[model samples]
Target: MKTKIGLFLVVALFLNSCSTSKTVGKVPLYEVLVVNNDGGANIKFYEILTEANEIMLLLGDETLKKKVKKEDAQKSSFIILNAGPTKETFNRATVQKVLEKEDAIEVYIKDMQKNVEADLANENVFYPYSIIKINSKKQIVIK
Candidate 1:
């Protein structure tokens, strides 16, 4: 009876070991590329382009196509949002998370808070922009 029990335990352990596995995650869930903020006086401040046509229209060129390889015009959420023209060149921004909710994908960003006071007319301005690549194309909203 002892030998039989040991055999059963061995079988059980083998089965368990075969079934155990570590969850493998997809390498890149999303990609972010900081473009620029030179469009300082852009009246249309922040622009998030999720489709190829819109990106082409806004950029008026093949810049987006050149950036992302194997481009999926329908499912590409490319962000060209401007964030600059500030006095501080050392300021920074970070991409926190990108999530898909219903028909839209939200892009979360952490950036240094700007001063409440308006910039003086003569203050040096800088343009800071970034491009976000959503894994699946959909509406890209910045928050």
Candidate 2:
């Protein structure tokens, strides 16, 4: 009986070792690019993550995607400045603090419409892409 028990334990261990479990990762449902509409910044795309009527933008690459919690992304707006493209890839990001939506939009519109060489002093203009979140009424309100 002891030998049989040992054999059963060995079989169980083998089965456990051979067993595989699938890991489900958060997949990006929507992708939007914040482009300059001018000839300046390197454009990059973000994956929009939504939950509980709130939204967050996740930065992703070819293989892996990072998850953004709704609370952490609760800001007036996000800004993505051109980080400059490397020989291997083009990376744009919102590494800085979130700015006011109006401020970001003003900068973006100015950069897009203006071609004044003198205004190039303030050329590092960033754009804003407002994420409208669904409210309790099921109506989309700009966040």
- Estimated TM-score per prediction? 0.57, 0.28
lDDT of 2 by residue, 5-28 (tens): 999999999999899989898532
The C-alpha stretches of model 1 lying farther than 4 A from their native spots are 1-27, 35-44, 57-66, 113-123
Clashes (backbone N, CA, C under 3 Å), per candidate, total: 6, 0
Name the TM-score of candidate 1: 0.57
RMSD of 2: 12.3
Angstrom error of the Cα, residue 90, model 1: value is 3.8
Candidate 2 regions with alpha-carbon error over 4 angstroms: 28-140
Top-TM-score structure, candidate number: 1
CA-RMSD of model 1: 6.8
Per-residue lDDT, model 2, residue 87, is 28
State which candidate has the highest lDDT: 1
Instruction: Quantify all predictions' global Cα lDDT against the true fold.
Output: 0.62, 0.33
lDDT by residue for model 1 (59-95), tens: 4445555655544456565665555556556435557
Give the clashing pairs for model 1. 36-129, 37-127, 37-128, 38-127, 75-137, 85-126
